[model samples]
Target: MLTAERKRKLLEVLQSEGKILASELSRRFGVSEDTVRRDLRELDRAGFLQRVHGGALPRTPTSVEHKARQKESTDAKKRIGAAAAQLLRQGQLVALDAGTTPLAVLDRLAPDLSLTIVTHSLPAATVLAEHPRIEVVVIGGRLFKSARAGVGVATVDAYRLLRPDLCILGAAGLHPEAGVTTFDSEEAEVKRAMIAHAARVAVVVASEKLGTVAPHLITPAGRLTHLITDSAAADDLLAPYREMGVEVVAV
Candidate 1:
C-alpha cells in the first residue's frame, strides 16, 4: 500500500485497538519494518499518533488546542467538576489547575463555602475573582497559550512553596502504568510541583482519559489521593487506580 494509505490504516488500527505494534504493522502491510517505523515517525510528528517504545498509542485529547478541548467533553467535565467541588470545605487552601474541568469545579463551589484558591490558570482565577466569599491568588508566569495557563520557572517555584490543603489538579491522561500524564513538558512541571506540596491531590477528568497515556508524566497514579471521573467509567477501568489506593469517586 501507499504511504498515506498505510498511515491512515495505522491510525484506524491504533484507534480501534488502543495501540499499535510496529512489527505487527509491518507484517500486515507487507512492508519492511523500517518503512513502517518511518511512517509511524511521520504520523507522530503530525500529531496523528504518539509513538511509544515498540508501538504507538492514540494522540491524547491534550494534543488539541485549549478551546477545542473545552468543547469535546462538556457534560462529563461538569459532573467531574461538581464532584470535586463537593470535596472542598470552608477554610481550605486549594490550587485550581488550568482547564475547563477546573472551571466546572469553580462553577459548583457554593457561594458561602469561604475558601482561598491559589491558581496558575488564568481562566480559573477570572471566575474566582467574582466569587463573593473566596480569596483568589493568581500565580504569575509566562502565559502558556495552548493551555491558557501560566508556566515557567516562576510558576513551578511558587507551587513548591505553598502547601495547599488540596489541589484540583489538571491531567491529560491518567493511565495505570504511564501514570498521570500531560501533553506539555512545562505543564507537567507545573503539575508535578502542585502534586509535591499539596496535602491531597485530586484530578477531575473525563472517563476517556482513564486508561490513556500522554507524552509527559506529572506523577504516578498511585501518588494521587483522589480520582474523580464520570459514572460512565467501567469497573475494570477504575480497578487499577483503586488498587493503587486512589479514592475513586465516579460522579
Candidate 2:
C-alpha cells in the first residue's frame, strides 16, 4: 500500500482503538516496524498523537493555558464541580489542587459552608478567599503561568506539613494505565505531596481526558479515593477505575 494511504489507515485505527503499537500496525499494514515508527514519529510531530514508550495515545490539551481551557468545557466543568462539592463535609480541611476543574469546586460550594482550604494555585486561592467561613492557606512558590498555579520546593514542602481531610485533585490526563498525569514535573511533585498528605483524594476532570496519557505522572490511578467526571464519559471508559476500587462518580 502507498505510504500516504497507510498513514491514513493508521490514524483511523488509532481513533477506533485509542492506542497503537508499532508491531501490531506493522503486521496489519504489511510494513516493517521501522516504517511504522517513522509514520508515528511524523504523526507525533504534526500534533496528531503523542508518542509513548511502545506506541502512541491520543494527545490531551492539558498543555493549553488555564484561561484558554476555561473557554472550553463549559457545562461539564459545572456538573463535575457540583458533584465534587457533594463529597465535601462541613468544617473540613481541604487541599485544593491547581486546575480549572479543581478550582470550579469553589463555585458550587454553599456560601455558608465552613471549611479550611490550602492551595498552591493563585487562581484557586483567589476564589476560596471569597468564602468568609473558609480559611485559606496559600502555598508560596514560583508561579506556573500556564496553569495559574505555584510550583517549586516551597509548594511541595507545605503540603507535607498538614494532613488535609480531603483533597480535590485535578489531572491533565487520566488513563487507566498511565494514571493521573500532568504536563509539568514540578506540578506533578506538588500534586504527589498532596496525595501523600491528604486522607482521601478526589480528581475532578473532564470526560475528554479519559483514556489519554500526559507526560508526567502524579500518582497511579489506583491511588485515587474518588474519580469524578462528567457523564459524557462512557461506562467502559470508567470501568478500570472502578475495578481499581475507586469510587467513580459520573455527574
Candidate 3:
C-alpha cells in the first residue's frame, strides 16, 4: 500500500481499537517495529494519536475545529489555492465555498484586485477582510458551529439574489459515479445553491477526497466546469471527470 493509505489505515485502526500495540501493527502490516514506531510518532505530531512506550492511543475526542482542519494539508492546499486564484479575474464577482481548500484560495487572493467575494465561511470572510480592494460579503444565517459556516434557509435565500461569475465548490467526496457529496445534508443544500447561482463551478479537492463518498449528495459530475486538485491525485481516478468534459487542473 502507499504510505498515505497505510498511515490512514493505521489511524483508523487506532481510532477503532482505542489503542494499538506497535508489535501488533508491525506483524499485521508486515512492517518492522521501527517503522510502526515512526508512523505512531508522525500521527502523534498530527494530533491524531498519543504515542505510548511501544504503541499509540487515540487522542481525546473533541469537535472538529475549522482552523485545525485548515492546517492539515498546508502545502497541497497552497498549490490548489494558487491555481484557483489564477482563475479569478479583476472586477468579477465570485462565491467561495466553505472548507480548508477554499480558505487556502482566499489566502492566495491578490489584495490589489478589484472584485466582490461572497461566502458563508467565517474563515474565508476573515481572510478576505484584510484585503482593501476586494468587497467581502458574508451571508448571514444560522451558523454550523462545527464547520464555522452559515447554512439553513437564510443562507440559501441570500444566494438566490446574487448570481456570481464563478463559485469555488468544496467537496467531501468526488467519486466518478457518485459525483460530489458532503458530510452534512444542510451543507449539501448550501453547496447546491452555490452551484445554481454561479455561472461556472470549480471544485477544489485534495487528492485524498477523490474517491471517498459521504452521505449527502450536492451536485452531479456534469455540473462542474473545472476540477482543481493537487499532483498527488491519480490519473486513472481523474479520467472519469475528464471524460465528462470537466477540465482537470492538477497543481
For candidate 1, the per-residue lDDT at 139 reads 94
Show the colliding residue pairs in model 1: none
Model 1: per-residue Cα lDDT over 43-139, one tens digit each: 9999887777787777666544789888878998888888999889899999889887888998888889898999998888888888999999999
**Per-residue lDDT of 131-235 in model 2, one digit per residue for the tens?**
878889898889889989889998888998889999999998998887888888999999999989788999999999998877788999988999999999999
How does model 1 fare in lDDT?
Answer: 0.86
lDDT sort, best first: 2, 1, 3
What TM value does model 1 have? 0.86
What's model 3's overall lDDT? 0.83
**Candidate 2 lDDT (Cα, 0 to 1):** 0.88
Off by over 4 Å in 2: none
Residue pairs with backbone overlap in model 2:
none
| Candidate that scores best on TM-score | 2
Q: lDDT at 234 for candidate 3?
A: 82
| C-alpha lDDT of all candidate models, in order | 0.86, 0.88, 0.83
Ranking by TM-score: 2, 1, 3
